[model samples]
Target: MTEPERLRADAVRNRAAILRATEELLAHHHPQQISMEQVAAAAGVGKGTVFHRFGSRHGLMRALMQERAQDLQTAITGGPPPLGEGAPPRARLLAFLGAMVELVARNKGLLAALGPAPVATAPEQEPREEHPVYRAWHGHLSRLIHQQRPDLDDDMLAHVLLATVHSEPILNALEHGAADRLERTLRDLVSGLMPEG
Candidate 1:
């Protein structure tokens, strides 16, 4: 391959390594405590490389979130069935919520770190509404709600539903091994919103 091609391959590998290292660190350490230097050391890359690639801690967290949520995004866009394209609106909505439950459960630490802070928060923090993953999920949910009940305010309702899954209550349930109950509650909530005829 050409020198440029080799350099591109190296960059890709380095990116993957950095994300993997960040994920591992998030599993054991709070997001606030995991510095760029730590991530660089863990990934076997230079601190400058990490900074150059991600720009800042927030950028790195966002990149990690995108990487983690890529599979769900692909499935939603193109995969089959309720989580994908072929189901009814209510079914699809429920499936999406269920999938999000699992995703949030698995990545609670990272999600908490990336979650929106209060209005008075620092400027560097990204709000949940502005995050790319949140936007995609909100858009999907809003579309599904519109399909089911055009009379409702789908945009606001979408935010409400997303909030249900991302809230402290859901996180606490997952921590307490009450995921089954949590899923049931979510199913009930969605069903209530889009009741069958």
Candidate 2:
């Protein structure tokens, strides 16, 4: 291969190796305790490669989170319902929240280690309506909302409803002793807010 092509291929390999190592280690341990050296050892790459690929520990953590978000978006879009399909709107909403809660529970250590990343940024010029994952969740929720409450603006309601489901306040509630209560409250909220026929 040409020299430039070979370098590109190697760069891709390095990034993949680093991400895989980070995911595996973070799955069982907290990010603060997993040093760059340990990640390199786990990936069987030199420590220099980890630094070169990710620039710093924080960058690595951000990449891991972005990867996870993309994976979760796919699974929820295509995996199975109530998470994926075939369930009632309330059931689907509950399942989605439950799945998120379980994921948070499983990754609590890693999350505590990474700290809060800013939740919002400048909107991309590309219309989010055209994005597959955005459309999937928004479309599903919109349809369900319209079915229950035709008087409400489905798009607006879907946005607000999902924002509540994912907001930090709700996550905090789940992390504390209020997960069950929160779930019931969320279902009740959805029921009450949805339009009656």
Q: For each candidate, how many residue pairs have backbone atoms clashing (under 3 Å)?
A: 0, 3
lDDT of 1 by residue, 1-197 (tens): 99999999999999999999999999899899999999999999999999999999878887887776878999999999889999999999889888877776777677667664211122565666886777888899999999999999999999887776666666767767776777788789878877887
Model 1 has an lDDT value of 0.82
Per-residue C-alpha lDDT of model 2 across residues 75-183, encoded as one tens digit per residue: 6678887777677766666676565445554555455554431122125433544545445556777877786668889899777755653466765665576656765
lDDT for residue 156 in candidate 2, whole number 0-100: 91
Misplaced by over 4 Å in model 2 are: 1-17, 27-29, 113-143, 153-156, 164-169, 177-180, 194-197
Q: TM-scores of all models?
A: 0.84, 0.63
Query: Which of the numbered candidates is closest to the native, going by highest TM-score?
Result: 1
Q: Model 1 segments beyond 4 Å from truth?
A: 115-127
Task: Name the lDDT of candidate 2.
Answer: 0.67
